[model samples]
Target: MKKWLIYTFAIAILAVLALQLFMFSTIQQQKNSDEKYFNMAKQEYKIFVPYIPDSLELFGENVPVDHVLVRERLENEIVRNMYWHSHTILLLKRSARYFPVIEPILSENGIPDDFKYLAMAESELTNAVSPVGASGVWQFMKSTAQEYGLEVRTDVDERYHLEKSTNAACRYLKASKQQFGSWTLAAAAYNMGGGALKRDVDAQKTNDYYSLLLNQETARYVYRIVALKLICEQPFQYGFFIRNKDLYQPIPVKKVSVSSSISSLVDFAAEYNLSFLELKNVNPWLRSDKLVVNTGKTYEINIPLSFSHTKLTENIADPYTIFKDSIVVE
Candidate 1:
């Protein structure tokens, strides 16, 4: 009886020891796996801000970066971009696609090349819709779009039209510079309207946009633009790299003008040898299926230039369109 009892006690002690050993091994393996992942993340992704040109300064009151307040604001944006990893990566990817379209528009209108960053500040180069009803990559409100010669109606909102909207932005910037006498102030006015910008300049007795005490969004606007410009121009320093094929290319489109109303846009697109999706993809500004054109107004509708991949002649399994060439409808 004593021998049997001893055997039972020894077996129970071994079982407990084995269970503890298994638990420890599992925990150690998990810890190692987590460490490996963390190390990989650290090596693969890192954010770094590059050197910026003094001539292209944004929110410094035409003053240098020595001021304490100015330095702080700049630092805030740098930190924001560096830490907001996912958002910054997306911006980098999308910029490669959108910059080709935006750059020429800025140049033709004589707006500063640096103003391309304003698009990043506005909608991150996205066709974003704001709560106040602003739309498109440039984020123009209803009145602003119309006032700047963009057609805005229920059937057609040209604010969603990238080319026309960009041109409108250029006009506004030109007018603002004429009023405020500085490109920086013109950019600020783009955020806070021309009237408000003028009022602020007068009220503060300072012509500089950065010198005036403004609301949070307006105050941070220029700094954000400059930071993005710095980061985007030298993405290698920020650890961003992708194949050229992976980068987004723009679409090639042929513009067709119309002055009279059509019954169905779907049928109209078909007549032009375009699928309805193709028509909509090229002309996102067209908000409805039915066309209600004003007789006297000339509207530009973009049709995709036929390609071997998406041509009607090809046995393409899908009708989806891919943007390959940068074509503007201005």
Candidate 2:
């Protein structure tokens, strides 16, 4: 009987030990779960959001941001450009290369400084061609480019040349400013047409750009420009931070004049110790393999002063930091 009692006591001790272990494990699991939730809460609440400015201007005209719709629009763009790190950073880099070329042209033509942002909006400072044939930084249609004295031909298209195209854009914008009597409306005219904007103004009996109801592109046009203007000025505020050296530098080139018909552009490029692709890449205006030149026209082609054996045709770097970080060399 004493041996039986001892066995019961041993079994009771084992049950108590098992209960303590299970309780310890349950408490440890709950502690781990609490720590996980706490970390998530910290991350979510710690993010900083930019605030809207009380007042703003575009092309020297005051933005009616006090209005509910206007405030929402500005806030929307700030969020877009702020959070869109890759695209905006690319623009920030490209702007460093292209803005220097375009800014002085705007000043020379008596256009407002703000209009450079218009180019940023139109093409992201790229040599992009629109589906409707609007080409270059300013996205000018072929007919409009021709109307502004740009050569829109098969063999020689000046619209691709940065300086010449920017000058042409200045002319168009200057004319729009003249017709509209306000640079704000002038900008809207660029997206739609000056005729359309003017007709809408007259029919609606309003000259205020902010008050009129425009088609989607024209309506959001000025807002987009303003958004870009703010971001370019304050890149750090919008989360795009870059060193000055990170921006693309403009290549130095020497210009050669071609007056007569060139039967072979390949031979022309070879004369400068450059490949045909190199010549065409720098001067994208050269459309065909051969350049056909008639009387009363002289074309100038720019050749890079120096290049490395590594790159055949120089192009801008990708400028995306995330992509730059991911590259692993073998």
Candidate 3:
């Protein structure tokens, strides 16, 4: 009887342990399933949804962005970028600083204000380079830069020179507009050549930019430009907030024109009461350490007129602190 009681107690204990193990495993499985389901639901919510504009027909013959496929893609990008709130805000802050420099150049060239968005699309207003050797905010390749009257060589690359590059871009845009007879088409041709665009229009028997089939990059190019314009122009609507001080401002500089060869730029800068870095910062086009004077070419070097030695010695407590940070080099 004692043996039987002992055996029964052991059996009961084993049964309880098995039951507990089964219950625990089942609860774990339920928890995993619940987590998976929640994740799946969250992903589903992120799917692209196109904003349907009433005048869809106005964009006729244009690639249908409002269509199910295009809308999904656009919505995906918009949402992904919108949720990336920090980056958008930074872009806004930077634009304020750079637009002043860009706008006047465009206006002087008679190019539309809308074209400012091209730089935003090209380089995000930062000096950027491409795999094919395009460089600067305008992304000019070697041949293109040369064709547009920009000197691109071992020492001097005018593509980094914002004023010169903007001038070149203006000339190109004006020529394109004359060829295409439309600002919209001219803007498109800036990516694809005006002649090629003309041929495409002829082949498609449609003058409408959106109606004809184009390569993926070219097709999306205008829309991307327009999207950037809309977003940057109305930052509050797109949820980008920035302060005036956060925007970049152009530095004050004095211009000194030199027609003769500068044997030593360092000496020349010191003569004018400026540093070599300051001289190079203002005139990025002067590529060489020693300026080989093109006898006919009159080169203009910019010097900072604001920083006088007397003012600094009297007013500035820490001259070391002032020189520590990098001044605008390009």
Point to the candidate with the largest TM-score.
Answer: 2
lDDT of 2 by residue, 135-209 (tens): 888887888889988888888788888889989988888888889888999999999998899899999999898
Better of 1 and 2 by TM-score: 2
Q: Candidate 2, overall lDDT? A: 0.80
- Candidate 3 is scored at a TM of 0.66
Q: Report how far off residue 248 is in candidate 3 (Å).
A: 1.4
Show where candidate 1 strays beyond 4 Å.
1-42, 47-63, 272-275, 306-330
Per-residue alpha-carbon lDDT of candidate 1 for residues 238-311, written as tens digits (9 for 90 to 100):
44443233344556677888888878999998898888888987788998987787657788888888644334
Stretches of candidate 2 above 4 Å error? 1-47, 307-330
Candidate 1 similarity to native, TM-score? 0.73
Ten consecutive residues with minimal summed lDDT in candidate 2? 321-330
TM-score of each: 0.73, 0.77, 0.66
TM-score ranking from best candidate downward? 2, 1, 3
State which candidate, 1 or 3, has the greater lDDT: 1
Residue range 129-233, candidate 3, lDDT tens digits: 888778887888888889999987765678988888988988888898787666767777887777789999889987666566877777777666656655665
Q: All predictions: root-mean-square deviation over Cα?
A: 10.6, 11.0, 14.6
Per-structure clash totals for the candidates: 0, 0, 6
Residue 302 lDDT in candidate 1: 85
